[model samples]
Target: MKYPSLKNYINGQFVASNSARTIKVVSPVDGALLSEVTMSSAEDLNDAVEAARIAFHKWSKTPIKERVQVFFRYKFLLEKNLQELATICSEENGKTMSEAIAEIEKCIELTEFATSLPQIVTGEVLEVSKGIECRTEHVPLGVVASIVPFNFPSMVPNWTIPNAIALGNCMILKPSEKVPVSSGRIAELLKEAGLPDGVFNIVHGDIEIVEAICDHPGIEAVSFVGSTKVAKLVYQRATNNYKRCLALGGAKNHLMVMPDAIATMTAQNVVASMSGCAGQRCMAASAMVGVGPIDHIIDKICDEARKVVPGENLGAVINKESKDRIEKYITEAEQQGAKILVDGRGAKVDGKGGGTYVGPTVIDHVTPDMAVAKEEIFGPVISIMRTNTVDEALAIENANPYGNAASVFTQNGGVARYIIERASAGMIGVNVGVPVPREPFSFGGWNESRFGVGDITGKSSIEFWTKLKKSTIKWNPEAGVNWMS
Candidate 1:
């Protein structure tokens, strides 16, 4: 399928970079040449920034009703072309078709929420003293930038874009070079929905582009979602430059299966969470803490995982690099004395000889010191670490540097309450596998998993993208008070 446009969308137009450098887009499913995207240079980013600075004056001044109307039309356009966008996302990002469609549907819901910005962006009004009023209003931060990861390309960008734009902040989106097409399509839809030139821009490149965004004086804030290592760097550099930053890093999320937990349901949820998107999700349950005789759970998960057929039930990782990395983790785990229960290495997908497929792999007898257990594999690999008590499981989960997400399976309310309250993770799942907060609630992490003041998505986004200004007013007509005084 042809992409919307292979060029960067800057200044409300599809344009090529000054360097004319191109990154070849390839399909992970079959390693086919999809398209070539123009890579933006520092100079290109400067131009985009200039355009955004100009647009911000008007966009910020635009009435909330008008801004929301544009988003309404954008939402309709998204719904109108849902299938087309979903297909593009799946083909480029190597996710299943249904997964991509579901991502688009979520994006639609986010847009729907954004259309009610007039209500959500409301500030506090209070009466102080006699005839003296005090209130606070939320206003736009100048130019903001968003750096989204390749996994869930279509969905992650919406975590910032709609909220930033709705709050009247001009935005520059830097999509992962691995899957840039989906954001390009979104830029097109934004323009179609009557977004003016420069209000929203897309810049395409790798590290240099990202560094430029951080160091650029024009950018007031930066929001990012990526590996923990990179996120730390982004946070430091952006904040060092005196710009606000919200860097959401990677996770080594754990799914603790208690003895009382339903074996079948726990296993099913584990498999679904760990293997979804080939385990490329940040919230993918890569570690399983087995509290008791969890042998049945592991066996069922391994059995179901082995049956998943690539290109049907599962898809390839983003590229061969990811596939190789996942395989190396598996091999290293075996060498370090961990048992490879079901090896995904060398697994074959039908008619996809060149594809980057790593079938679902499970490793048993994982220890805390094991590299595979500590790191974010970002693949369809689940490792079992047995613990005798709930405290042991909680210790294992909390010891990780990343506090992105964690879940516990139990029938007891007291145990669930204990885990929810004591676990260091930001987003917790009691019975649910992946606890991604919906539109209104903020989604964030703790410790190394997140940096900055506010979270992305939901109401937190409004605060992240806007600044607050307080006003104190007094009117004393009887005393003839001077306005300046």
Candidate 2:
């Protein structure tokens, strides 16, 4: 059984890990090991970094139009193998085939959006300051390390690496050790698309390798997407190493319903927003807040949530530990005053709960200080918190530690506008369920929820990849090439 002998894609080749130590890729649906991947260590990360450092010169100097052509081909290759990509994601990541396909669609959009780099990378020329015509041009910041999360194996890579590569920066990616195969496969496809050697490298492993990648002086920038604590660590280390970083942290997204907001629709949106991706998404709805019909809204939400029966081809948590942690949170909540409205884990499951199956568990009368509300469960669980007025709801939301993505389910445009205006979250969705930022827009969290300055994709990505250098071109015919002053 050949399982794509996973290895670090360095210098345009698949380099084997130094040790035979491997991480087994498992299917959360049944807790089956889909494949075994040899883990890369700190030495392997150094090798990949060295390879990227060597490849950056030619890759960066490569013509922008030529680079764009590569992306066009890459898009075609991705579409041609969309099903294969989907299968890989489904097998290892536990996302249903449909969800996996959707993830690919997001990657497709990112690459398509990225091909427009020629237009986006356009600089401006201002003719106002004396006889000087100041012009700006974006230049790649050498080698960059893009660390992606597990839940979003392919989509996240697109968010970080594409922008880095499109803007001429060579990207050395360290995918999650859990689902490293999909990312490694993507690198192969990128190679087939004719991206130069070392233009985009792939390495997979644990903190040993990740720390090395973070501490590497040669890595000019680091873009990380993971938990808040890890993001803080990466940011602190990367900055101390004098490298730039954009580390997005865990989120406790709130979906508040105003008293005037629609009830049935809001409930359904909350269900999908919180349960989609098995609540593994960074912006997954964890806390539900609103002023109107708190009791009725809770009932409506529970009704809709019950619709998400386990083994209905939704998705599973990343691993058993994650699933267990989610259960622990629920169990502790039970010990607390909160009551479980729908025990997705215990109610009914197609497979065993021992396997990564946590359907959509809903809790009611959850307080702000509760562990369920305070923690980032990263699973299909919702803690319904009530407020007396819209003011109280907003205040509750504002008090939370995380402010990643929040949405409002109100037909009332005034209230929606006010929420959008006043909410301190990074991404806001009105009627939309998931507030993941598209390719053209920046995606990030706020406060302790996000670290450093840029986003995974969108405009901030472009900025993250390049260093803006202002050239003060003073050509008065007075400053001749040979004449000083």
Off by over 4 Å in 2: 129-131, 347-354, 474-485
Candidate of highest lDDT: 1
Model 2, 138-211: lDDT tens digits are: 88999899898898889989887667897888888988988887887898899899898988888878887778
Clashes of each: 0, 1
Which ranges of candidate 1 are over 4 A from the true structure? 1-5, 479-485
Which candidate has the top score in TM-score? 1
C-alpha lDDT score of every prediction, in listed order: 0.89, 0.83
Alpha-carbon shift of residue 366 in model 1 (angstroms): 0.8
Residue 155's lDDT in candidate 1: 88
Question: What are the per-residue Cα lDDT tens digits for candidate 1 across 322-413?
Answer: 88899999999999999998888987777888789888888999998998899999999999999999999999998998888999999999
